[model samples]
Target: MQEQEVQRGVLALLQRIAPELEPAQLDGRVALREQVDLDSMDFLRFLISIHEQYAIDIPEADYEKLVSLDDIVAYLRARLPTS
Candidate 1:
């Protein structure tokens, strides 16, 4: 998968988890939880959604690495199989 694709997928999952999020207003460098005001459960759901959408395993230990949009995109880009 490409970077844009990964980014879109992340944004989509985030939107699903937090419908009030405005994608255009989001800062890729900022923490997602801070931007969207996501609680622990919502954040967990976001990770689960990413795992389900990409068919990849996101181990609990790596959760801290996915704090921002940039981080999530980089994480997914590194794991997703290329076409």
Candidate 2:
């Protein structure tokens, strides 16, 4: 998948996880926790959901890199096997 497609999928996944968040709310520069108001546990849940959905094991150390919507997409794009 292309990077743009991964970003779109990440955005959709986030919306599915957090219904309160709209696509407009998540930009590349915005911090996921600060901008989205997700606490640590909430973020963990979000990560778990992403992992479950994508069948990708996102390590905790890698979590630091996932600071925003763009980051999440990039990380997933890099880690997920391309078809």
- The best candidate in terms of TM-score: 1
lDDT of 2 by residue, 1-83 (tens): 78888877777767766788877655687788787877787788888888887899987788889897878887888878887
lDDT of 1: 0.89
Per-model TM values vs. the true structure? 0.95, 0.83
Off by over 4 Å in 2: none
lDDT of 1 by residue, 1-83 (tens): 88887888789989998888889999999988888888999999888998899898999999999989999999988887788
The RMSD of every model to the true structure, in order and in angstroms, is 0.8, 1.6
Error of 1 at 79 (Å): 0.5
Query: Which residue pairs in model 1 clash with each other?
Result: none
> Quick one: best lDDT, which candidate?
1
Model 1: CA > 4 A from native: none
Q: Indicate the residue-level lDDT of 17 in model 1.
A: 86
In model 2, state the lDDT of residue 45: 82
